[model samples]
Target: MLCLTAQSALQGRSDRSAWQYTRADTPGTGSVRWLAVTDHFHGEQVLRIHVVAGPDSPSPGFPLPRAGEVVASPAMQRLFASTPDDQLDDRFPGEVTGTIPVDLLSHPEQLIAVVGGEVPGMFTAAGIATSPDHAFFAFARIIVGIAALVLLVPVAVFVVMASRIAAAQRERRLAALRLVGATRSQTAAIAAVESGIAALAGTFAGWLAYEGLRRVLASSVTYEGFPFHAADVRAPLAALVLVPLLAVLVSVFPLRRNASKLPTAVRALPLAVGIGGLFLVTYTSAAGFDELAALFVISTVVGALVVGPWVCLQVGRLLARARSATTALAARRIEHDPKASFRAASALVFAAFAATYLSGLVSAYGDLPGTGIPPGVVTVFDGRDREIVSDGTMADEERIRTREAIASPNAIINTRREFVLRERRLWDDVESAVHFAVTIVVVVAGCGVAAGAAGGVLERRRSFALLRASGTTLGQLRRVVVLETGVPLVAMTGLGVALGVLTLVATKGPLPTPGFAAVVASGLAVALLVAATPLAVLERASGIDAIRPGTSA
Candidate 1:
C-alpha cells in the first residue's frame, strides 16, 4: 500500500513541473504580484493559478497569507482582485499564469524529493487530494455513526433472550432439587448455581463468536490505507462476567414469583411467562416511550420461555382450521402435549434467526449499488508549467489515442476495471455494516416462532390424549403434521420470496437481476425452515399416551 502511494506521488511529479519564486508584490518588494499558472488538461481552454502575493500590501488579518505563500487560484484571484476583503470559495477552478512549474521551483530546495509519481501537495495536487481533510472525515463519521446505531437492536435482543433462558432454566433446576427433599434455601442455591454455570457457558460461546469474527475480519481483505483495531480480550471477558450478572439481576423477580407459586402454577410457569412477555413486546413496540418500551421489551423476552408450549397449541389450531380428515388428529396430539412438542420445536427460534438474517444479508448485498465509472478519459493535473504523470482513468464514450509506446493498453479498459473494483467494495461495505442487524432480526423472529410452538403444545395436550384414546397411530400423527406444516411452509415460502423481491421497492433500491434472484432464494429457504416445525413437533408428540390422564411417559 505504501509503495503504491509513493508510486502515485512520483508519477505525479514526473508530469508536473514544480517552481518556487518570491512574490514580486510583497510590501517591501517590487509592485508586481508573482502568480503561479498551469494548463488545465491537454486542451488550452483553461488555466490554473495560485496567488503568490497581494499587490504591494500585507493581508488584513493575523495569520494572513505569508510573503512567499501561495494564496488563491485563477478564479479566486479574479474574484479577490475586486473585493480585496472577500473570502475565497474553496472550489475555485485551477489556473496557471506567472511562476515556474514545480520541478523548476524545487531546484533550490532539497526538501522536495522527486518521486516517480505525483507528489501530494496543495498547489501541485488536483481534485480531492487538493480538498480539505475535514470533508472526508465528516463523511466517514456519518457512515460509522449509522453502522453503530443500527447494531444496537441486535445487542438488546441478545441481552433480553439470554436473560429469559437463564431464568427459565434456573427455575426448572430449582424445582427438581425441591422434589428431591432439598430445602427452599438449597433449591434457591441450586438455581443460582445452575444459572451461574449456564451464564459462564453462554459467555464462553459469545467470546468464541467474537474471536472468530475478529480473525475473519483480520484475515479478510485489508483496507489499503485504513486502520482497523482488533477487539480487546478484556472486553470479551468483561462481557462474560456482565452477561451472568445481568441474568442474575433479571431473574430476581421471576425467581421470587416462581417460588411463591403452587406446584400446579409451576407447571403453568412457562406459558404464563411467555404470554406476559408477548404482551410486553406488543406493548413496547406500540408505546413508543423509552421507559415503557424497555419494560415491554423485557416482557416480550420473558415470553420466549413459554414459546415452545404456545407454538404447539397454535399449530394444532392451524391444523384443525385447515379441516383435513387427519388435521384433527394432528392438532389434538400437538395441543395436549407439553414436553413432546417442546423437544421437537425447541429450535424454532434458531431457524427463524437463520431465515431472517439470511434474508437481510441477501437483500443488503443484492441492493448494493454498482460502480458507475465510465471509460476512456484521463484527468491531468498541470500545475505551474508541466503535466502530472498520474493521469486519471477515463470515462466511457471518451476516445483515447494511446501512444503505442505506452505499457498499458488504453484508458478505456482501466476505467472499466476500476469501476468493477469500486462496485464490489461498495457491496461488501454495505453488507458488513448491516450484519449485526440481520443477526438480531433473525434471532427475534426465531424466538417468536419458538414461543408460538411451545404455547401450541401446552394447549393441545388434552387433544393429544384424546387422539391416543382414539387409537391414532404415531405414524399417522407424524403424517398429519407433515400435511399441516406443508401448507403453511409453502405459503410462508411464497411470502418470503415476495417480500424479498418487494424489498427493492420498499428500500427504493434494486441491483442487477442476478443479485435480486439470489436474495429471493434465500428468503424461500428461510420460509421452508419455519414451515418444518410442525413435522418435527409431530415426531416428539407421536406417543400420545403420556398426554392421557392415566398415563406417564
Candidate 2:
C-alpha cells in the first residue's frame, strides 16, 4: 500500500501541468493560449495562470487555475470552478483570490509564458527543462523507491518465516493423519482447509493492522512537504481481494517442496555471495546512486536468506569436533536442521545491513563542506579589471537586482548555501523515515526469532524427552538448547555486521564508530536474548512428559 501511494504521488506530480490547463469549447481537446505567472507574496511563492478561455477550451482532467479566483466567460465557469478559498488560504496567505481571464488582466507584461496551445506534453518538457525542479523530483522519486524497498524486504522476510512455522505444524499434523490410514488426497484437503482458514484470519488481521497504521501515518508522516491523508494511503478494491488470495497461495505452495533436501539453501548460498560481491564492486566502482542503491537492497536480501543457514552449518561443524557430549548433541541437531535456525535469525541479518547502510549514509552527509558565506556580506566585481571587492551589506532587492544584472555570473551569485540546505533537508527526512522503518524491522525480527526458537523446541520435544529419559539432566538439556540457538545466532550476527561494514567502506562512507558499535552490540544482545528466551520458558516444563513413541519420526 505504501509503495502504491508513493507511485501515485509521483504520477500526480508528473501530470501537474495537464491538471492546470484545459480547453473550453471542446472541453477535452483542441488548442488554447495560456500564461503562467510565478511571484513571491508574503514570504511564500504563488502561482497564477491566465488562460484565453472561450467556447473551445480543452479539459486537462483535473482542477485548474489552482490558486486564484476565476474571471472567465460563463462557458469556462461551467467547465471549471474557481480555486476554493480553503485551498488558497492554506497554500497562500491572505484572503481568497480568483483567476483572471487573459482579457481581464491589466498588464500582459507580467505573464511568464504565452504558450500557443493547451499542450499536455508541456508538463513533461517543462519538468525536464527546469533543473532545480527536476533534481527535487528525482530525489523524491529515489527516496520513495528506497523507502518502499526497505518496507517490503522485512515484511517479505517475516512472511517467509511465518509460513515456515505454519507449514511445519501442518506437515506434522498431516503426517499424523497419514499414519491413521488417511489417503493422500484426504490429507491434502485437510491441510488446504486448515491453511485457507488460517490465511483468511491472518489476512483480516493484517487489513485491520494496515488501517490502524494508515490512520497513524496519515496524521504523522509527510512527503515532499505534503501530508499523507487517508485517501493517499487507501489501497484499491482489487488489492483487498488479491492480497488475501496471494496470502493463501503463499501459505499453501511450500508444501510441495521436499523439506528433506537442502538444495535450496545450497543454491541460495552461491547467489547470496555472488550478489554481495557484485554490490561491493558496484559501490567501490563509483557508480551512480541509483545503481548502488539497487545493488545494496538486492545484496542485503540475498545475504539475509543465506547467511543464517551458512553460519549455522559452519558452527555445527566446528562444534561437532568438540569432545563434550552436550556439544556433540547440539551440533548434530543444528546440522540436521539448519533451516530452523536460519528462519529464526534471517530477519536480523537484513536489519543489521539496513542500519549500517543508513548510519554510513548519514555520516557521509555530515562530512560535507560547510562553506556558505555569512549573511550581510556583499561581494562585487569590476568588469575586465577582474578585481573583486567585499564591503557593505546588501538588501534583498539589491541582491536580486544584482543577480539579474550579471551577464555571466560565476562567483558572487553562486553561493552553495541554499543547495546545501536543501540537500540536508532531503537527507534528514530520508534518515528519519529509514530510522522508523529499521525500528519496525528490528522489532518484527525479534518476534520472529523468539517464535522460531519456541517452535524449534516444540518440534524437538520428543528428542529432548529421550535425552532426559537417558539420564541427561534437565540443566544439561537446557544447555544443549542454548548452545543450539546461541552459536548460530552469534555467528550470523557477526557476519551481518561484517557485511554491513563492508558496504559502508565500499561506498566511501565513514564508519560511524559509535553508531556502528551500538548497532552490533544491540543486534547481538537482542538476537542471543531472543534465541535463548524459549529455553528459559521450557525450563519450567518437564521434557519427559512431552515424549511419545510415535512422535519421534
TM per prediction: 0.43, 0.64
What does candidate 2's lDDT look like per residue over 271-366, in tens digits?
Answer: 455456655565555555455566555655675656567667777889999999989988998888776666666665666666767767776776
Summing lDDT over every window of 10 consecutive residues in candidate 1, give the lowest-scoring window.
106-115
Best by lDDT: 2
**Prediction 1 TM-score vs. true:** 0.43
lDDT of each: 0.38, 0.53
Predicted candidate 1: what Cα RMSD to the true structure? 16.1
lDDT of 2 at 284: 59
Model 1 regions more than 4 Å off = 1-189, 221-237, 245-321, 325-375, 381-424, 431-466, 475-517, 523-553
Give candidates' CA RMSD values in order: 16.1, 9.4
Candidate 2 lDDT score relative to the true structure: 0.53
